[model samples]
Target: MSTRRTLLAGSTAALGLAAGAAHAAPSVTAPQPAAAPGGRPPNLVVVLADDLGYGELGAYGQKLIATPRLDGFPAEGLQFTDAYSTAAVCAPSRGSLLTGLHAGHATVRANPSSGARVP
Candidate 1:
């Protein structure tokens, strides 16, 4: 097989392995906190930068590009270093983001592999 085909096959296999492991693992649910004094919920901003690797930021290990915006946002808000996207591609990654659901629970993961404009 060609190198491109080999790489694609490897990536597919890796995704399958991750899915299986996630399914086999026991589920743990955190306790819900009581509502605050006011009825309004906290404001949230979820930012997903496409094609960004973990080491692409100054907070990680990048020493080349300057990422002052990213470096400051987490400090002003919340910083979740352990968060992960369900897929390694844009379309599916976005599906999870807008719906507040995992890629495994969404139909988009199985179709159009990646890169579709959000409706």
Candidate 2:
């Protein structure tokens, strides 16, 4: 299997987060809603920027921009000190988000202006 496929398969099984199993939208009627009595997996929101630098946000060293949302989020939640993208450019950066693959394994590396299709 390709590296991207391998990474995705490994991550899904390790995390116990199944894929392709039809799930209802969040509602009270859903079966076994939310985690059990014990602590459950925290919601994950993976935000990726195409070319945004580490110092691009107000929380970072960007002095001019006023990013209230980004700055205030750390107060409510944890802020990671070291975060990086899968690639330095756009296309591969997006591929990582879709397939959960690393930059080295991304087939759609570089700018990829040739219109790539997602599986």
TM-score top scorer = 2
Q: Can you tell me which runs of candidate 2 are displaced by over 4 Å?
A: 1-41, 113-119
Across 55-116, the per-residue lDDT of candidate 2 in tens digits comes to 87777678998878777767677676886677777777787878777777767777746666
Candidate 1 has its poorest 10 consecutive residues by lDDT at 25-34
State each candidate's clash count: 0, 0
Q: Which residue pairs show backbone clashes in model 2?
A: none
lDDT string for model 1 (1-119, tens) is 45433645665676676667666646633323346669654454557788888888886778999998888866676565776667878777877666656688776774363556545
Q: Give the CA lDDT, 0 to 100, for residue 88 in model 1.
A: 77
Estimate the TM-score of every prediction: 0.51, 0.57
